[model samples]
Target: MKLFDFNKYFPDEKACRKAFKEMRDREGVVCQHCGSHDVVWLESKQQYQCKHCRHRTTLRSGTVMHGSKLPFMYWFIAMHLLTATKKSISAAELQRQLGHKRYQRLVTKQEHP
Candidate 1:
């Protein structure tokens, strides 16, 4: 998606989280610990609790952005940039576009994960 469309769709962290939850629900949330399909949404905790195992799964648990310190908006923008063009974007260029002083950490987390 284009930057404008991405921004329009995912305007903030809350929006991103809601969208992620909806997508996960649509696909069915399986418990990583017990491999059970029976899960409940814990709205207060913003996590999915496995009915069989009581294991909790966060929104980013299995996503590329899992464990990343950056905000969802940053990840969203990075995804847009990465897919927007035919040629791949350098981490440095991405950092510049992101206007973040420290790009190494973000790039490393995304690359390794």
Candidate 2:
């Protein structure tokens, strides 16, 4: 999607989180700890609690941004830019477009994996 379309769909962190939660729920959240599909949404904690094992799976768990400090919006925007461009988008260009002073981690993440 274009930047405008992406912004329209996911305007903020909350929107992105909600979308992510809905997508995960639609796909069904399996308990990584016990291999069970009996999971409950813990809205307060923004995680999935495995009914069988009681293990909490975070919204970002098993996602590309799991351990990243950057916001979901950043990742979403980065994804859009990376895919929308006809030519390759370099990490430096992406960092510049993101207007982040310290974007080494974001760039490195995109590069390594």
Candidate 3:
């Protein structure tokens, strides 16, 4: 998608989170601990609770953005930049484009080199 189109679809962090949640819901949320399909979404907590194991799964769990504290918009924009271009993007360049101050936030040590 073009930059304009991406901006149109994801205007803010809330939109990105909503889109991510929808995608996750479509893929189905299974309990990682008990292997159960019976999961409930706790909107207030922004997590999924397994009916059998009573385990709580974060929305970012089992996804690429797992364990990340950055805003959802950051991930969406980074993904858009990576796929919307033909050439490969470096970690530093991606950080620059995202206007993020920290280089480590965008890539791991193994990925940076």
Compare candidates 1 and 2 on TM-score and give the better one.
Answer: 2
Candidate 3 C-alpha lDDT tens digits along 7-86: 99999999999999999999999998999989999999999999998999998887777667778898999989999989
As a whole number from 0 to 100, the lDDT of residue 108 in candidate 3 is 31
Q: What are the TM-scores, per candidate, against the unseen true structure?
A: 0.82, 0.84, 0.87
lDDT of 2 by residue, 1-113 (tens): 77788889999988987887887888888888998999999878888999988998887776677666678888878888999999999888988999987766784343322
The stretch of ten residues in a row with the least summed lDDT in candidate 3 is 104-113
Please identify model 3 stretches exceeding 4 Å from their true place.
Answer: 108-113
lDDT of 2: 0.82
Better of 1 and 3 by lDDT: 3
- Give per-residue CA lDDT, model 1, range 29-66, as digits (tens): 88989899999999999899999989999877777767
Residue 1 Cα positional deviation in candidate 3, in Å, after optimal superposition: 1.1
Order by TM-score, highest first: 3, 2, 1
